[model samples]
Target: MNVGIGLPIGDPAALLSWARRAEAGPFSTLGLLDRLVYDNPEPLVALAVLAGATSRIRVQTEVLLAPLRDTALLAKQAATLDRMTGGRLVLGLGVGGRDDDHQVAGVPLTTRGRRLDGQMEVMRRLWSGQAHGDGAGPIGPLPARPGGPEILFGGFRPAAIERVARWGDGFLAAAPPTWAGGLFDTARAFWREYGRDGEPRLVAQVNVALGPDHVVDEARAAMHAYYAFTGRADHMVAGLLTTPGGVREAVTAFAGLGADEVMLYCYGTDPDQVDRLADAL
Candidate 1:
């Protein structure tokens, strides 16, 4: 199993520092969380900086909310990042759930799933250089590659699983064990039914903070902040808080469940937090 670290997108200096450290850490990849019109910096721009800063670690957007932006523009940005990163970009995408997030983006929250699906289709066409003009002629300049970055779909719903099987290169499972089990099973089944070879690549994100003290209070505080930001407190409680053993156990569990990669977010921007996790992992 490959391990990756999530860089805090809210702090530019800290993000850069963490990227530098991650290039030398045990992690094989560096991930950035996406939040438009929130405290977080733009994932694509942050990734651009990371592309220039690191040479080896793969850069990923743990997820960028697809329904919140223009599909063609996003494809261009992702392609540019992939080119800049020397084809080391993994684009994880989702249809956002938070109403306030959509409000911030000035888009309606309803039908986000449908919009996301459409956006994905359009992006694939644009990336593959098959997108056509209004009269069905070839469109403008294409992405650096004939196909764009590897795209992964994130969520634990049945529809999400189906979407991943139909259109994505892999799955990004985010729910706790109960929800994740069903989603994984569904994804595998869909892959088999679609005649795809092997299993789809799975990437799981878990909140982690490592220290000798097993800081439950700190973990809970971080969970609260995550909930406050994402507004999905109820869905994440069990999987979000962790002791040292819990962190190890979570990693073991995800590995056992066939995750190809795991990205751990250490809940805060403190360098000490990153150091603790680096030591623990």
Candidate 2:
């Protein structure tokens, strides 16, 4: 199982330290959460900083809200970052689910899905130097990877799976239990229909809490807080907190589900908390 760590987008200093530590540790990639109108920094820029701080660890946007930006510009930025990182960038795209997110971007939520599809098409074209006559000229000096960064679509719906098959390199799923069976089935179907004759890459994100029995409650509470803050309380109760196994069971379940890579975001932004989780793993 390939393990990756999440970089805190809300705290620049802590993010830099976490990126450096993750690179120095056993982690394979560094991921950033994306939120445009929120106080967090832009994902691409945050990735650039992470690239400069780490040598081998790959950088990824856990799920950038693609419908909220200019696709051509986003593609150009991604290509530049990929080049700077020597082609170690993964662009994880998603249509924002929260209506407030679109409102903040001045984009109507009603058109998010269509906007995402259109933006992805334009972004792919620009990345491949096929974006001319759309008035956005060429995005020269592409990344070392011929086509550009690996594009992964993030969603659990059937439409999302089909979109990945049509346009993405892979699928980025949420934590297990909440996003296991249905999500995997959709990915497999998409792969059988449109993927190469090999295992399709599947990336998942989960909260991690590692320690003796002493910290189990703290970890559970932290995980609960995460879901509540994200408005995913229903999932937290039904999929996460309903069981006694907690984070460890959740992590093992994700790996057992054939996840190619799993990124763990410690419930809180505490570096010590992350360290505890890592040590336990």
Candidate 3:
């Protein structure tokens, strides 16, 4: 499987440096996570900036919260970004589980799934040059790719996995390989059930921390802080791959399960970790 690197949670000043390093390394994509109520930079804008700074590597939202945004505006923004980036954008979206995020965005938490379902159709139509209403013109500029940038859906629920066949180009498994294999299978099954012509792209993400004890500890702390809202930070922390061998093993396991790409989610802030990870892998 191709390996991608996530933008680490660290000094904002170092983010560009980190992205540049990741591009120069063996990584295939630069992935970012999204949270409306979090202190981290917004994934789309940050990724656009990063994409401008890098030449070859793909830029993606590992999973952006789709139900929190205005659908039409999001379609326009994503399309513009895709056009500007020369089709390097991979938009991975999910109906986020965090209530606070929905609350902050003024979106109803209970309606997120329905909202995402409707929004997907609307966005697709807009991207395809359909007007919003009788007098309104179509949104522009069109995406670099004809049907919009390649979209991947991320979520644990069956309905969410089914969306890959109905609306998405692939599945983004945010869980570890062991837990995510079943989800990936469900997505593929749905794809076949819908009579899709080819296989749905399967991508897996794993939390990773590498380097000296202090840097690794920093990564552990960052993960705990981010996932603290789930009340399962310890469980998430327990799954982190800290050693070089562990990273290699996780990549191999995900690849064995037919993941097209494995996103190594680095939580440490150090930009040099990119080089270290490249050497390790």
lDDT of each: 0.76, 0.74, 0.91
Q: Give TM-scores for every candidate, taking all chains together and pairing residue i with residue i.
A: 0.88, 0.86, 0.98
Q: How would you encode candidate 2's per-residue C-alpha lDDT over 211-242 as one tens digit per residue?
A: 45434455556556445657766566344222
lDDT of 3 by residue, 163-205 (tens): 9999999999989878989998999999999999999999999
The candidate that achieves the highest lDDT relative to the unseen native structure: 3
Give the worst 10-residue stretch by lDDT in candidate 1: 137-146
Give me the runs in candidate 3 sitting further than 4 Å from their true place: none
Ranking by lDDT: 3, 1, 2
Candidate 1 structure quality by residue, lDDT tens digits, 5-108: 87754457778788888877788788877776567778888888877989999888878898999877787788878877778898988887777889988778
Clashes of each: 0, 0, 0
All candidates: CA RMSD in angstroms? 2.7, 3.3, 0.9
Q: In lDDT terms, how accurate is model 2?
A: 0.74
**lDDT score of model 1?**
0.76
Those runs of model 2 whose alpha carbons end farther than 4 Å from true positions after fitting are 210-231, 234-248
The candidates, ranked best first by TM-score, are 3, 1, 2
lDDT of 1 at 156: 68
